[model samples]
Target: DTAVSQTPKYLVTQMGNDKSIKCEQNLGHDTMYWYKQDSKKFLKIMFSYNNKELIINETVPNRFSPKSPDKAHLNLHINSLELGDSAVYFCASSLSGTQYFGPGTRLLVL
Candidate 1:
C-alpha cells in the first residue's frame, strides 16, 4: 500500500553492481516492508515481511531480494543491477494496519 511517500534520490551505481539497503523500525511493529517507485513517480508495495513469513509480489524481478533478520529490521538486496532497476526504494514498517515509511534510497544503474 502506498501512502504520502517521501522520495529522495541519492545512490548512483553502475550496472552489475550489487545494491543493498537496511531498514529498522523501533515502534515495536511486527512487520517490515519494501516498496518500489512506480512509473507514475509514486511508490507501491513490492515485498512485505510479517511473522517470519515473507510475501513478495510476483511482478518483482529476480534481481531483487528481501530479507528480514528480526522483527525490527529488514533488508533489500539487489544484485546485478540493470538500467531498469533505477528507481527509489521505499522502506517501511507497519503495525495495526498503519505504515511508516522512510525517505527512500534512489538507485541509478548506469
Candidate 2:
C-alpha cells in the first residue's frame, strides 16, 4: 500500500468555486503537510499538522484551511478559487528525517 494518498486526482472548477483535496497517510507519521506546486515547480508548504492538530501555518490565504479528521488524515479545502490557484497540490507525511508524498492532486481553475 502507498504510504500517502490523495483523492480527486484531478479537479477542474470555475474561478469562484470551492474544492477540496483529501489526503491520508498509512505510515503512522505524526506530522502531515499540505504543499502546493506551481507551474514553475516551486513547492511551498501551506499547512502542517501534528497528531491531527495544526502546528504550522504559512502565509497561505485565509480561504485555505486544513481539516484533519484523524491523526492519519489531513485534508485541504480551498474556497473562492482563483486562476492563480491552478497547480498541483501534494500531501506529505514525515517521521524522523524522511518524508513521504502523495501522488498529488492537480487542480485547475478556469
* Cα lDDT tens digits for candidate 1, 1-110: 33323333488889999978777667788877888885579877889899557965557888888878888778888899998888888888888999888778888889
RMSD in Å for all candidates: 4.2, 0.7
Clashing pairs in 1: none
Clashes of 2: 0
TM-score of 1: 0.85
Alpha-carbon error at 25 in model 2, in Å?
Answer: 0.7
TM-score of each: 0.85, 0.97
Per-prediction tally of clashes: 0, 0
Deviating ranges (above 4 Å) for candidate 1? 1-9
List the global CA lDDT of all models.
0.78, 0.94
Q: 39-103 in candidate 2: lDDT tens per residue?
A: 99999989999998999999999999899999899999899999999999999999996889999
